[model samples]
Target: MSTKFNTFILTALASSSSFGLTPAASALPPVTAISGYSFTRSGMDLNYVAIEFDAAVLPFEVQAFVSKLGGCLAVPENGTDNFNAAISLVLIDTGAPEDNAAWLGIVHTPAGDGELHWSTIEGDSVYFLAFDKGGSSNSPEAPLGVALDAHSQQWFDVTLDDGSSNIRRAVLSFPASMLDCDADMIPDALVLALGLGEDQDGDGRLDWCAPAGDFNGDGIIGAADLSIMLANWGLGGETDLDADGTTGASDLAMLLAGWQQ
Candidate 1:
């Protein structure tokens, strides 16, 4: 099993009434980079790239200094050793190399720890940073180590910007294993946002990434999800999984087909 952080703060925020986690907000589109938020993956690297928190979370002043907030996890391309199963994150300058902000206690894991889990990369240097273990010293609790033989499979360029419509990407590489790719690698935060659970295998892949008829995103198409579909019967939102621009009998039929899967 993979490690599970406290995630109390994130869960509270997620369950808040103000977030408007209706089907629309909860159903994360497949787009690589949106205007305000974007999370995508390539090979072993699941990139947060850029996360612009809404003004409701942080005031404008504190948010300005922040540029791109990126995190990545690398795993064996073939085997299941997951040598570098640990996840790490970094904050980069806003295209201005000299303006790199080294402020600690800013980036945090889902547990809301003051520090990132493993070593953080700044520029070309890698620094071994302590993990926020929520007052515990454990083995698996720590982030995964970087495999020495690991190297990036694909290249990514980060064109940093100051809150512009730019997506700055960060990549992590793994060993020279055969690339028989088969899963949609993504962060757990996105999984939870879509009502999926933690990565049970710790293999950097969610079991229910694209499950059919997950209208309510609770990982299942059940009564609650059906109710939502009925509520938005003729609308275009999360319930319209078919992208046919309507939530009618066709959509309802799909939900029924995948019930309790």
Candidate 2:
């Protein structure tokens, strides 16, 4: 697919289809210090849930649960035609486990209000799902009508409410394609934290998913890669993977090890 730049904002919503603020046409601010849950990238078709936190967002967390057996797309709220899309779910951790909930807010885009969207990073269409457990209440099934065998101890369906208002828990069904950025048969999330999808080259594209081992960042590990490494040899710089203050045989070995066979 051709490269196109898409802008997104970080907010306090847990649904990818939800963005609470205006979309900025710039690279997202860097993400530093994420805590709480483990981020794992997988190569097989399996079921797992990842709970992530961003220190920059303060008390907001994202929980991504994947079930290879089956998944669904996120649904729009009642009477609202706008589809809110987000790269990651923004949630509020209520200190108390029983009241914990994730919320999906409205999305703003250049094309008007729409769901949070991004080019398929992994090259597959991902099914999404959202449902209200009804504010402080628990439900065995989601209201959006998708059947999920929510057996993992890490997940629970809970709702947030203030007697008059209520919000629900959400889950996303992204295909294996969405997570694998390098096509090296590994999900990028497995190697780095979230926000690695930000645009870096100013080429109207995101370098977050750039393939690994392409030291020169030209999208390939070829002669240019070797040349670049050799040039940087004895000088600690881009080729210094070991970071021992110099690029030498050890760095060359590492570079060769990553050579695209």
User: How does model 1 score by TM-score?
Assistant: 0.26
Q: Judge candidate 1 against the unseen true structure and give its global Cα lDDT, from 0 to 1.
A: 0.32
Off by over 4 Å in 1: 1-219
Task: Give lDDT tens digits, candidate 1, residues 1-261.
Answer: 232111111221222122323112322222121111112223322222222121212211112222211222222232222222222222222333222111121122223454433322222223333323342233332332222111222111121122321222222322112111112233333433323344564433354454545655677668888887888989965566554667788878877877897
Best TM-score among the predictions, by candidate number: 2
Q: Model 2: per-residue lDDT, tens digit, 1-261?
A: 111112223354232222232122221123321111112223323112222323212111222212121222222222111121221222222334322332222111122333333211222332333333342223222221121212211212222111222223332333333333333322344223333344454322236544434666777677878887887778955566554667899867866766773
Q: Distance from true position, residue 221, model 2, in Å?
A: 2.6
Whole-model Cα lDDT of every candidate shown, in order: 0.32, 0.32
The TM-score measured for candidate 2 stands at: 0.27
Clashing pairs in 1: 86-144
- RMSD of every prediction: 17.4, 15.0
Model 2 stretches astray by more than 4 angstroms: 1-94, 98-165, 182-196, 200-206, 209-220, 223-261
Worst lDDT run of 10 residues, candidate 1, spans: 174-183
